[model samples]
Target: MKIQEIREIIKLVDGSSIDEFSYEYEGVKVKMKKNGLGNAQQPSQTAIQEPQFANAEEMPTTKPAKETELIKPVIEEQTADLPGADSDYHKILSPMVGTFYESPSPDEAAYVQVGTKVTADQIVSIVEAMKLFNEIEAEVDGEIAEILVKDGQLVEYGQPLFLVKAN
Candidate 1:
């Protein structure tokens, strides 16, 4: 019912595999739904109802006009003249929606850069979601050909972060 409680619920939903959640207490109602990856038909929505008391003696009234859509973050695709065909490269994608960091921290050097050789299990970057920093690994042994996303950029689930030319 409180703002902090609502935020906690949102954090839990964002970090988990659950696609939808709804809660109702007294006359207050809350609903949250996540859009399916690459599913253009359904857009993500989170609705919260604020109780409005018409008079001291009457119960709170809920209105549908209070519902609002949460705007998703969008990152423009960076264009680059790649050396080879698309199939010749391996894409390192973000596993969750979060802020992408090229390095562990601001003062630290990046895990990898263009032309840096990397192994399949090497941590190439970090994606911070719900205040939890997640290390993203290069799933294939390759040389970094291009860095697609910018550092500290807000990225979506399954968005490409880098293009590596497989060794």
Candidate 2:
């Protein structure tokens, strides 16, 4: 399908009360789902699978199994013990699903480190999505207490990126 058609479908889904939608034509498949907040729907996954079979015999007898186990290793537990664990700390959350970048570039210094004081608008990190790098700001004025995610780590939307001791 054309990009315009896909965009129109997204708009339609977003404005309507539908929670999920799916479409398949030819070899292309598109699936969209809302985040359960009754907000705009996001395209969770889009795939184009074209079967290249010269004859019925060329097709495989069984369908490939989904590798759900491989995804488990990507999620790691955060440190359980830290200084001021009992105290109130603000969490800097990722605004979107993307790769977390500590620095603007490989050779550049990180935007902030543990114990680095930051203001509410200070740029703390970058999240690259769809080739666009979005600078994430420290939403609360505080001292960086812990960096939760490693550089180049894949982050999910609303995932905690940093812990901050509010000033």
Candidate 3:
């Protein structure tokens, strides 16, 4: 394209809050995203994450390529702490990739808020993706200490959905 056209495109992107724009034509795709802009300004972006789930029968339980023979002597000691000490924390991770809906919408009440009691299989929120609504349930029974997402926010896979005080 012409230099003036490219400059205009850049200007179009720079003037909007939409991060990451892509244009494709004639087998050429141009993608640009606003990076470090939020960092330079305020920190209001709410991070969203969704959980990934595969069929239990299809999941594999194996470690690949342990490239650490030099620490053979410390292997046993290292193995002792492998599980990590904070394994006790109750984490409610997202179960799907979609837009996180804290409530039905901006005018509705959130399903459950911080300090709310929840049990296993309780519907905590809904994720809207691909024109479908997936209800996210609680995997454990506990009081919610913090919710990791806001209403109408786009979420990614395997993001922290909430922090629960385990019972």
Candidate with best lDDT:
1
lDDT of 2 by residue, 13-111 (tens): 767778788886665566766556444575433222333444566445533222222122233333345446555798888887678999999999999
Where does candidate 2 stray beyond 4 Å? 1-87
Q: Candidate 3, which segments miss by more than 4 Å at Cα? A: 1-85
Candidate with top TM-score is: 1
The positional error of residue 28 in candidate 2, measured at the CA in angstroms, is 15
TM-score of 2: 0.54
Two-way TM-score contest, 2 vs 3, winner: 2
Q: Write the per-residue lDDT of candidate 3 for residues 1-167, one digit (tens) a residue.
A: 22223334555666767766776554434456555544657632212111122444432242211113212333344334332225554666666656799876678788899889999888888888767888888889888777867787656556667777778
In candidate 3, list every pair of residues with a backbone clash: 49-159, 50-156, 50-157, 50-158, 50-159, 51-94, 51-158
When sorted by TM-score, best at the front, the candidate numbers are 1, 2, 3
Give candidate 2's root-mean-square deviation (CA, Å): 10.1
Residue 50, candidate 3: how far off, in angstroms? 26
